[model samples]
Target: MIVLKNPHLSVHIDEMQGAELRGIYTPDARNALASYEWSSPTPVGRGASYGSSEMDWLSGYRGGWQETIPNAGQNCVVDGVELGFHGDASRTRWSIVDQGADWCTLETSTRLPIRVRRTMRLDPDRAVMYIEGHVVNESDLEIVFLWGHHPAFPSVDGGRIDLPDGCTIHPDVNRSGDLLTQDSPWPMAKTSSGEFADLSEQPALGSHRLLYVTGNKVGWSAVRQPDPYVSVAMSWDVAKHPYVWLWTMRQTPEYPWYGRASMFALEAQSAWPYDGLAGAKQRGQGIKIKPRGEESSWMTLAIIPNGSGTVTGVTKNGEVTFKSSEMH
Candidate 1:
C-alpha cells in the first residue's frame, strides 16, 4: 500500500495491482471517516494471483462476491434480464494507466459484453478530484446499464447539507409506502424554525447521510459541520445527472452500517427516483448512441480546505462552465 499524505489530506494507493484509492482525507478527518464501517476497501480488493477466493468473487457464478456499487442497492433486473447494480465497472479491478503529483488514471473492462475506462484524478492544490467514465459497446446488441458516482462523506453532529438553490426535494416512498418528512431544509431553512410542511422530517444526523435530487443543468451540495472546522463540497454536471441520493442510516438497529459514521454523499446519477436502466425503460429516458460511437460524462468534487471551493465541468471541445458553488 502506497500512502500519500500532506498537510491538507492523506490518501492510500495500491501499486503493482491496479492503483486504487484505499483511503482519502486529512488526519483530522480520521474520526469522521473511521466512525463508519466500510464493507470493503475503497478500491476493489483483488489478489495478486488468480485463485478460488479471487475467482469466486470476480466470476459471475459465485454468490459471495459483494457487488461494488455504492449507496445501498442491488443489481437491476427487468424482464428476466439482469443489469448488475451500479454496473460491473466499479466491482472489477482497475489498472493504473498514468499518474502525477495531483492526478492519476485507472482503467478496467467488463466480463459479459461492455468495455469501460474510468479515470480518477485528484489535485490537492485545487482541492478537487475529477472522475471520467468512458464506455464502449463491444457487442452488437445494445447494452443497458446504470452509471453513477457515489462518494460517502464523513458525518458530524449538528451537520447539515447546503444546496445551491432552495429547490424542493422529495424522497421515494419507504417500504411501507410512507413518505419521510422533515422539519426544514437545512442550511436553507431552520428545523425548529418552521412547521412540518411538504418536506420530509429532518433525518436525525447520524453515521448515515442523505440524498437529494436536482434538475438537469448544474448544482452543488455541501456537508457543513457545526464547529466550522471541516466541510466537504461536491459538484457535478446536471446535464447528465439531475438526481442525487442522500442516504443516512444511523438509528436502525437491524444493520451494522447504522450510525457507524455519517457521510453526505453527493451522487451524480443519470436518472431520478429509480435506477438508470429501470428509470429509462419506465420513463423513456434512455440515452441513445450510434453504432461504434461513444458517450461521455464528467463530474468534479472539490473538498474545500476551509469552508470554500469551486466545481466546474467541460465539454469534449473544451467549452467549460461552472456547475455549482459555496466558494466564499
Candidate 2:
C-alpha cells in the first residue's frame, strides 16, 4: 500500500494492480475512517477470482474471459455472457499513469478488449475527491457491460440519501425488493414535504449502506453522519449518466476489512431501471461508440463537514442539486 499525504488529508492506496483506494483519512477532523471487508485475490472454482462469489467473475465455460478473448488471462464474463459487474475492469491490474500532490491517474486494459483510464483528484480546499472514467472499446466487435462506481463508506446512523426533482425511489425488485410481497411500483410518489417515502425503515449503520435507483435526468445523492466530522457528497454528469446505485454492507465474521471499518458505497451509474446493456435496449437511453471508439463518464464525491454539504449533478452546464437537509 502507498500513502499519499498533503496538509489537509491523506489517502491510502494499494500499490498492486487495481491501485484501489484503501482508505481516506482527514487528520484535522475527529471522524476517522474505519476498515471493512473486500474480496480476496485468490482464484477459485470455475476460474473465479477473488475469495467471495460476489466479486468473482463467472463464465459459461472454464477459465473465464481469458479463454474467450485473445491475450486475456482472467475471468471477465458471467455464465458465458459478457457483463461488467463486481466492478468494471476489477479483475485486471491497473498501472499508475500520472500522480501529483492532489491528483493521480490509473489505466488498465480489460478482457472485454476494452481499455479504461481513471483519474482521481483530491481537492484539499473543498475536501472533495473527483473520479473520471474514460473508457474505450478497443475491439472491432461491439462491447456491452454494466459500468458503475462502487465507493464504500463507513455505515452509521443518521445517514440518508437525497435525490433530485421528478424522481422516486423504488425497490430493486430483482434483489431485496423480493423480500416484500407487494412488489413496489416504479416511480414512487413523493410526499408534499418533497421527500420520498422510506421504502425500508431499517436504520443506517456503520456497516450497512442503503442502495437506491433514480430515474431523474439530473440530481445528486449524499451519505452524511451525525458526528458532524464525516460526510460525503456524490454528483455526476447527468446528461451522460441518469442512474445511481447505492451499496452498503456490514462487516461480519465471514468478511474482513481490507482497510477502513464498515463502509458505504453510493455509486452513480450510467442508467437507471437496469444495467447499461439492458437500459440501452429497453429504455433507448444508452450511448453508442463506433468500432474502437471511446466514450467517457465522470462522477464527483465531495466531503463536507456538518449539515452544510451539497451534491450537484451537472451536465452541459445545467445542474441538479441535492443538499444534506433533503436526506431522509
**lDDT of each prediction vs. the true structure?**
0.47, 0.51
Q: Give the top-scoring candidate (lDDT).
A: 2
Residues forming the 10-long window of minimal summed lDDT in candidate 2: 61-70
Best by TM-score: 2
Task: Report the lDDT tens digits of candidate 2 across residue range 137-208.
Answer: 887876654455545555555655555555545444453321331223332424334554453222333333
In angstroms, the error of model 1 at 270 is 0.6
Cα lDDT of model 2 overall? 0.51
* Local accuracy of candidate 1 as per-residue lDDT tens digits, 134-191: 6676667655545566555444455555555545554544420123433234223222
